[model samples]
Target: MRRLRMGMIGGGPGSFIGPVHRIAAELDREIELVAGAFSSNAGRSRAAGEQYRIDPSRAYADVAALIAGETARADGVDFVTIVSPNHHHLPAARAALAAGIPVLSDKPATATLAEAQELADVVRGAALPYALTYTYSGYPLVREARARIAAGALGTIRKVVVEYPQGWLAGEASGKQAEWRVDPARAGEGGCIGDIGVHALHLAEFVTGLRVTELLADLAAVVPGRALDDDCTVLLRFENGARGVLLTSQIEIGELNGLRIRAYGDRGGLVWKQEEPNSLTLYDLDGGCSMVRAGTALLGADAAARTRTPGGHPEGYLEAFANLYRDFAALLRGEPAPLLPGIEDGLRGMAFIATAVAASRDRAGWVPLSV
Candidate 1:
């Protein structure tokens, strides 16, 4: 199969997510970065292209020019990856799809709920392959957890608890990352919830294969002078008669990427932690507990397919991110790409953010999800 070419929008110098996207896309040797509008500034974009060794002609001034120039070229990119801020996600993806190129976008879909719905409509109408990078679901162990739950190893899930905490924004805003995240204009209605809470929400739903039917949220701006909520706690009711809790905060001092999930069922319970990505712990009802490590024979077919090394060889964030790219590339090659998060997941995330914000605003008891 031919190596797929990729173009990127955003992720220029000092940008947090752009290099991660580029690195993940290129990890498996299935895709190459052929072009990019790396930044809003034309000079930075060109400089980023030079740093990546891309041809100057392909490095356009902005997203519009990148889409136009690449589309006109015979060797244009096969797909476009949007790593821009949340506000740009909708427009960038729309432009790519309209130009007949597929899109792999960063999470939360759009800056607003209305835009997310419209984007969903456009993608469905276009009938193209559009994927959202819910990076946590790419882990081999996470896949193993999902497979086990689906097989009823954890029978009749009754409770779920997920949390994501970080201290990066605990103090006064000092960096570019903190600046946009705390600003409602760039990050949308949610601050911490939109940034990391969605990841926690998506992980819980992805593993249990259950939909959150309704939720009650208490969101707060913990830090002084912050415009958006830096702390959030949500109570969830699932379609399968399950109850859950979600906690996400950027002001938890000394905590760093502490994302974890636990699901309890009638028969057993399972626990997974993001910082310790290689292991999953399961506890049976009969006082029996076992730790399942990644790359082991216990993993199912989907998990084994995603595993890269033997058990005890640690694989963390970058590898997980790469798995999504690998699956998307396989999909573009017309092969089976099960478990890749697509437009529906993106839409669901946006809905969750919107609903949580509204629920918090009104102090409503439990708001049904309107996705």
Candidate 2:
């Protein structure tokens, strides 16, 4: 199988997510980093591209230049990974798509719902494949959960509770990660809700195949006078009559990306924790409980298929992220993609954030979501 020649738009020196994106894309051995525009500053962009060992000529000063030059190359890249800030996603994606290259963007697709809608529309009309990295959805256990729910193993989906909490922003690491995220101009209409809450919301709906028709939300400033929401909670009404609650926060003391989800149907419930991606807890209505280990003796095909190593060997965040990259590559290859959360998921996530933000402003009142 020929590997996808990949290029990146962000992940310049000292950027956190860019490295994560690189590792994930490389993990499955299906993508080769061919070029990049890594940063806004020309020097930094070239330096970051050099760090990846790409030819300096391919490390252009800006996204448009990268698109122009790369598209002209005989062996151009397969796609561009947009790991820049929320504000950069739209322009970068538009450039790539217009150049006839696919895009795999980091989440919250754009800074605003309107922009997100526009991107979705463009991608839909272009008939090109685009994916937003709701990374947790790429996890094996999460896939198992989806499989079970779809197979009627869960019977009737009833309730979903998902929460993602991290404390790096609790005090003040407010340097790069916290700074760009809280900026309305760069981060978009929603704050913590977009940064993490949307992940929780996506996780729930992805697993249960439920659509949140309406919701009520509470956006709180747990941090001292942060410009954007540092913490939030939302109550959800799924189209299938299931009830759900989501809490995503960056101000939780000592919390570090502790994302968890639980779904209860008429017959049983499935619970998975991000910290331990290799295991899922299953609870029967009759009070019997069991743990489904990723590499254990007992494992479903969906779960087993996603597991790359022996049960004890840990395959985690990087690997889950890699699964998404691999699946997207499969999609581009015209092969069967086990899974890929496309532009539709991106639109719904943006709508969730917008609706939640609106609800939070209206005294934590219920808000009907339209998508």
Candidate 3:
């Protein structure tokens, strides 16, 4: 099979997510990194291109130049990956889509809810394939959990608890990632809520297939001298009458990407953690418990299809992220791909961030989400 050519907007020197995106995109041998505007600085962009061994001519100064140069080529990139900070996601995506290129963007979709909606409208009219990298949804065990919940194994979902805590921003840290995330002008109205809480929110909705109808949130800047929130807690009311609690913190010491979710229903409950990832614990109403491991016969077709290793082996973050790229490549190849988070998910996530910010600011008890 011919690999689809890809261009990236960011992931310059010292960047975190760009390399991850590149690695994940190439993991299945279905996508190739052909071009990129890796950084804002022309020199740095060229340097990154040199590191990636991309043709010198394809290493443009910025995303606009990359889009122009790539689109003008007969062998232009088949798609564009927007790995820039929140502020750049909207423009890069808009340019790619307007140029008739497909887009795969990092999470939160855009800097704000309005931008996300605008992008969603453009995508809706374009009829082009666009996807959001809600990375956790790509996990095999996560799919297994979704399948179980959809199959009514967890009858009448009653409650959900999801938390994502990181210690990287525990103090006054200065770096590209930390700088943009804590700046409202760059990260939008939310900080921790937009960064990690959105992941928790998406995970809850993705696994349970329940939309958050209303939410009440409390956001705080835990670190001294920080402008944006470093910690937040949200109360969610699902459309199916289920209640949920979401907690996200970037200032929690010793917590390293501790994303965990648990859902309880009338018949049973399920728990999955990002740290372990390979196994899901299922609790019966009868007080019995069973552990469902990934790559096992017990997994559903969707989960099994995503699993690569056997029962005892492990698949992790990169693999889960690769699933999204792999599925997107399959779609571009005119093959049937499993459900991947699309423009709608992007809109919803942005809405969640916007509403949570509003709730926190206005002390709103329960704000109804309109996305």
Candidate 4:
């Protein structure tokens, strides 16, 4: 298959996610970064193009220029990747979709729920394949877990516990990344909740194939004078009467990307942790235990299809991210991308953020989480 050309919006100097997106998208040789509006600053965007070794003429000053220049060419970008901060996601995507290009964007969809809803309309109208990088859903073992739950390997899921804890924001916000994340205007209403909490929410729903119907939430800005919540605990009720607990915080000192999930059903329970991304553990009611490793025969077809290497060869964040890119590439080719997250997932995530924030702010007890 030919490489799908990709244009990037953001991920300039010192930007963490942009590099990841570039590297991941090109990993399988299915996508290539041909052009980008790497920064809002014209100089930086051009310099970034030079840094990436793409032709200087193709690097544009901003999204408008990128779209205009690229679309004018016969070999224009097949899709654009929006890796900018929360606020920029909507405008960039809107422009790309309007130009008749597909889009693969970073999660949360938009800065606010209203923006996400608007983007949804635009996506539907465009009739293009729009995907979100809900990266964890691409993990081989994560796919394995999802397949097992859906196949009734764990009979009648009763509970789900997903937690994502990071200690980077325990002190006063410092770096460029931290600055925008805590800013309400840039990152939206919920801080930790909108940031990492949405990932946990998506993972839980993706794995169990269950929707969060209602929730009672407690959100706090643990750092003094912070505008948005940095820590949160949400009590969830899934569509199938399964209870869930979602804990995500950026203020937990000593914690480093500790994302873990455990789900229990009548027959068994399964556990998977992001830090140890290779394996999944399952336990039965009578104390029988088994381990399912990535790239192993134990995994279902969905998981096996995603695994790239042998069982012992570890595949971490970038590979999992690349899976989404690969899937998006498949989607652009009119192939089925069953594991990919799209506009609906984006809506649910935005709703998760808006509803969780409102529930906590108003001290509302057990409010319905309408997506």
How many clashing residue pairs are found in candidate 1? 0
What does candidate 3's lDDT look like per residue over 260-328, in tens digits? 999999999999999999999999999999999988899889899899889899999999999999999
Residue 96 in model 2: lDDT: 91
lDDT of 4 by residue, 82-178 (tens): 9989999999999999999999999889989999999999999999999999989999999989989989989999999999999999998988899
- Candidate 4 Cα RMSD after full superposition onto the native fold (Å): 0.7
Q: Which stretches of candidate 4 lie over 4 Å from their true place?
A: none
What pairs collide in candidate 2? none
Candidate 2 stretches greater than 4 Å from native: none
Q: Which stretches of candidate 3 lie over 4 Å from their true place?
A: none
Candidate 1: segments with Cα more than 4 A from true spot: none
- What value of lDDT does candidate 3 attain over all alpha carbons? 0.92
**Mind giving the per-residue lDDT tens digits that candidate 1 earns over 58-97?**
8889999999999889999999999988998999999999
The lDDT leader among the candidates is 4
Worst 10 residues of 3 by lDDT: 330-339
Assess each prediction's global lDDT (C-alpha) against the native: 0.92, 0.88, 0.92, 0.94
